[model samples]
Target: MARDGSVLGMIEATEFLDIPTTTLADLLGREQVMDIGIRPLWGPVPRIAGPAFTVRCPPGDNLMLHAAIHRAEPGSVVVVESGDLDYALAGGNVCAVAQRRGIAGFVADGLIRDLAEVRDLRFPVYARGIIPIPGTKAAVAPLGEPVRCGGVTVAPGDIVVADEEGVVTVPAAHRTDTLTAARTKLAKEATETLDDWEAAHRSRIDEILARGGFRG
Candidate 1:
């Protein structure tokens, strides 16, 4: 199920980071990065950070995922853990519902369908694989509990970031602060001052070295 109202305050958590999920993994101490059998349904985006509104479900079961759509806040990324199985748990229908609910995108450890439709809608979905067959929603995986997915331990409300590099999880406490810093860092790089400096200096680091230091 998706988290709610300061439970994890996912809506608030997303305002913090600037880097892609892979970079967050680097910042998060290289916790674990898993690649599902499938590929990214969408391209990389700078709006890649979001609070982890999670959905854990039985392999091939999708009831809880559907339920999560209603609860997840807009701009939040919904993570669906399907026990690393190659079974389809979601697809275009769910994507449509999630989009209607204003979710940012999807990250599934299992499978999904309707890739073309999802792409046409310009929705983001990362998954293990795509199957023509859909799963039956017969069981529920524990929500708000930590579950291992794609090599990372995803706790409810943890900061989730995803881009072309794939998905990464950041600790909850650091979500707000760390991402804010990253945003600052990204902005400074994007500034005109930095561009002028790089153009003039060509090698900005060499000038810093010339400015000096302790003798070795």
Candidate 2:
């Protein structure tokens, strides 16, 4: 979902650092959560939260993603819609530059190279996997535009929260409401004791099972 420039800037300033993607996942619909294939390349990757700076890279060409690292603002998650995974979209130096520039991390639907260097830098990267071969830097695509990555349509400035669990994108238009709801959920969960949770869980499961007429 798109928002006005003024609101987009405001939303970008709001970070979900303490809120896990799991919490957001619960609050957001299934469509907002990325598929399992898009996972952290290296862990324990610290949770990253920021607005997305979207990019689209044509198959076998990564010029746009390379261009994005330089253009994206600090604390922005560079989300990419890679055309294919046969060639890597980025390498160690590219990740290094992005890290040096204070970019939050990368979420790519394709692949990347230089795992060792990225792991050493502790730069969070959630992608399909790694490849030895790198793609050419020839394709030109718009930066900061809406792109499809990991089965989710990510618009520029959408809030991206990612960690070991997974990646979830909160729409820019719903950022305020989602953040409020997530915080409320977390706070309530914190107050609930494990015993209380177990009791409630047991009761809920038993009710469902009874309705299903389970004999066991």
Candidate 3:
């Protein structure tokens, strides 16, 4: 599939955005869901869905990520694998440029700086945390390569759907199947009332309890 979201198509990307990461997590399981550590830098962050533009940054050097902001195509989510968290991977201006260039958002396995500026810009950033010191732009690495971020192995062109709840990566090969399943599940859920859900939930819990011979 094209990394530019052409082969995958922007229409599919828009569909992925309609489904929250939580719904994807339920379908893809924990393996596809990013860890809790990588969360939105600010609350009420708008959901972002796009193809993964993977980048690998060595410890104490964020050259690849810095380079990605300029090169990543519009609507691509820049996913980064930072070697360490001691130094920040990106800051305000870099994020600004990315947003200006029409990049969807960022998902980094390390830290970032200038949280206030990023928040003000309303740019979506999911990372470990924020720091004051920035990493050097020295080390070099390839772009669009597979990267391990937040315990999830993100590959280029994978559908990355992220919001305040969490980040979920839908494998490129299974994008269609995943989206279909997710939409089906959501449609079923939409018709279910809370009362109906509670009754089913209670019955399932009671059955499990009975099977375990729990007397409470």
Candidate 4:
């Protein structure tokens, strides 16, 4: 039997500072990062940041995703655990409805169909693969509960950040502190341009590499 959890209500969009996934990955550093294999299916170099509305579908069935989209608040990202690679849980039509509902985007551990239309619709979607095969809407699964997605645990209200790099999850409890740390790190980096700094430190880098047994 599948289980569902209570929706925690949506985290305010303003709650998410505009921090890039790359910066978040460097700061929190753990399974907080999803596997690199999950790539954007379409949209421009997207930067999606929103509270997670997690849906765990039984393998090959995505009925609960419909519920999740209707139940999710505006600016929420529906994170679905489709549990396999063969079936597409949602595609362009679903995405269009989601977009109208103010969904920030979608992140799925399974597949999605209608690539050209999905891209044409300009919805930001990230998933493991694409297939013409559609998912059946017969399984009863959990929505708003903690679920494993793309190798990380995602809970309702957890902040989801996805970009060209990949998706990263920041636990709801740690988002404020993580955002603060990421901002500080970004501030410091703004002063340290790397282009010439690396060149200037080439000799120092060579010395360290030599000690590590790298022969040039």
Best by TM-score: 3
Candidate 3 Cα outliers beyond 4 Å, as residue runs:
1-9
Worst 10 residues of 4 by lDDT: 1-10
**Candidate number of the best lDDT:** 3
TM-score of candidate 4 on Cα atoms, chains taken together: 0.86
- Candidate RMSDs in Å, in order, are 5.2, 2.3, 1.5, 3.9
lDDT of 1 by residue, 1-216 (tens): 333554346556556444656445555566646554435866543355666777888866788887888877777778877763655777788899888887878877777888888888888887776777877877855556676667677776677777777777777777667777667666765676866877768557666776786233
- The lDDT for every candidate, in the order shown, is 0.70, 0.89, 0.90, 0.81
Please provide, for model 2 over 97-198, each residue's C-alpha lDDT reduced to its tens digit, 9 standing for 90 to 100: 999998989999999999999999999999999999999987776677799999999998888999999999998889888888988999999999999999
lDDT for model 1: 0.70
Preferred candidate (TM-score higher): 1 or 4: 4
Worst 10 residues of 3 by lDDT: 1-10
Q: How accurate is candidate 2 locally (lDDT)?
A: 0.89
Ordered list by lDDT, greatest first:
3, 2, 4, 1
Per-residue lDDT of 193 in model 1: 87
Count of backbone clashes, every candidate in sequence: 5, 0, 0, 0
Ranking by TM-score: 3, 2, 4, 1
Model 4 misplaced regions, further than 4 Å: 1-17, 199-216
1-216: candidate 4 lDDT, tens digit per residue = 111222333443344547888899998786799997678986564688888888998878878887777777777889988667878888788888999998988999888899888888888889987999887888886567898898999988888989888999988888778878888988787888786678769978998999999997
